[model samples]
Target chain A: EAGVTQFPSHSVIEKGQTVTLRCDPISGHDNLYWYRRVMGKEIKFLLHFVKESKQDESGMPNNRFLAERTGGTYSTLKVQPAELEDSGVYFCASSQDPREKTSYNEQFFGPGTRLTVL
Target chain B: AQSVSQHNHHVILSEAASLELGCNYSYGGTVNLFWYVQYPGQHLQLLLKYFSGDPLVKGIKGFEAEFIKSKFSFNLRKPSVQWSDTAEYFCAVSWDYGGATNKLIFGTGTLLAVQP
Candidate 1:
């Protein structure tokens, strides 16, 4: 089975520009998540999707960032009017159904899209 | 706020040397710990995970981690490491928030360099 895959392995855009990063989760996986690493810092969670509905999005930093999983199989994170601080690597991950909070479920990650905002 | 810390920013070891990387997390209540490795030009991959049961867990590529609840630590270890083991190691912890997602808090990551 193929693991999670991300589009536009690397992206460069000017400040105030818009960029959309896509993530395709593994087949049959119902849980999708987005995370990012800024500079050399640790990876931080952004949001999560279970099927077509968003399970949690509290991690979202601000209103300028938006994430959607239309059909529940793929997800897109769009950043409007990107800032200089938006330069970093965005990673997408997926796992089996996450109905049970405490249940152990392995999450596979993608190669990550490196976004550079100048 | 909860957090994860990886003490070693970088470590250098000769091939066949014993290895141990310290990972500490601060979070009350139940948590699931994980160790992930990212090789050069590669995506992050799961090295091992600890949800419950035996605190000691073994993973692929001869890597292992022991979860010590008292210490609030889950340190990665290997009896012997090879040159192929050089990579960036990250430690993460996810809390059981009784919510839809387990928000994973990750460490700054440690770079391991193994000499041939």
Candidate 2:
């Protein structure tokens, strides 16, 4: 089975521009997640999707950032009026199930999309 | 808030050198730990994970980590490293996020540069 895949390996945009990053998870996976790592910072969770519903979005920075998973197939993270601080590598990950008795399911990650907000 | 910390930012070593990277986490209650490696232009891969039972856990490529409950740490170690081991190592902590789910928090990462 193919691993998770991301689109537009790299993206460049102005501070006020809008950018959308996409992720396609492995077949039959039921859970999807988004994370971002800024320069000199650790990777932080942004949000999670269980099928088409939002499971947890407390990590979302602010109103400018939005994420959605349509039909529980693919996910898109859109940053409207992107800011300089938004420049970082956006990663997407997926797991077969999130209900493991021990919560020890292995998460497979994508190569990530590098966004440069000028 | 829960978080993970990696003591080393960057480490350089020659092939066949012993390796040990420190990882500390601050979180109440039981926590699951993991070490992830990212090679150049590659995605993150799990080196090892510790959920329960035996504190000493072994992973692929001869990597192992020992979970010290008292210190709240899970450090990765390898007796001998190769040039191919050069990568960015990230320490992560996973805890219950309610509803039978877990969320992972990653560290800043330690870059290992192995010289052949």
By lDDT, the best candidate is: 1
What does candidate 2's lDDT look like per residue over B28-49, in tens digits?
6778899999999789999999
The DockQ leader among the candidates is 1
CA lDDT, candidate 1, residue B77? 100
lDDT per residue, candidate 1, A1-118, as tens digits? Answer: 7889999999999999999999999999999999999988999999889988888898899999999999888999999989999999999999886556556888889999999999
DockQ of candidate 2 relative to the true structure: 0.72
TM-score of B-chain for each predicted structure, in order: 0.97, 0.95
Worst 10 residues of 2 chain A by lDDT: A96-105
> How do the residues B1-116 of candidate 1 rate in per-residue lDDT, one tens digit apiece?
88999999999999999999999998568889999999999989999999889999999999999999989999999999999999999999988766568667899999999999
Mind giving the per-residue lDDT tens digits that candidate 2 earns over A1-118?
7999999899999999999999999989889999999988999999889988888898999999999998999999999989999999999999877677654888899999999999
> Per the 3 Å backbone cut-off, how many clashing residue pairs does candidate 2 have?
0
Candidate 2 ranges with C-alpha deviation above 4 Å = none
Looking at model 2, the pairs that clash are none
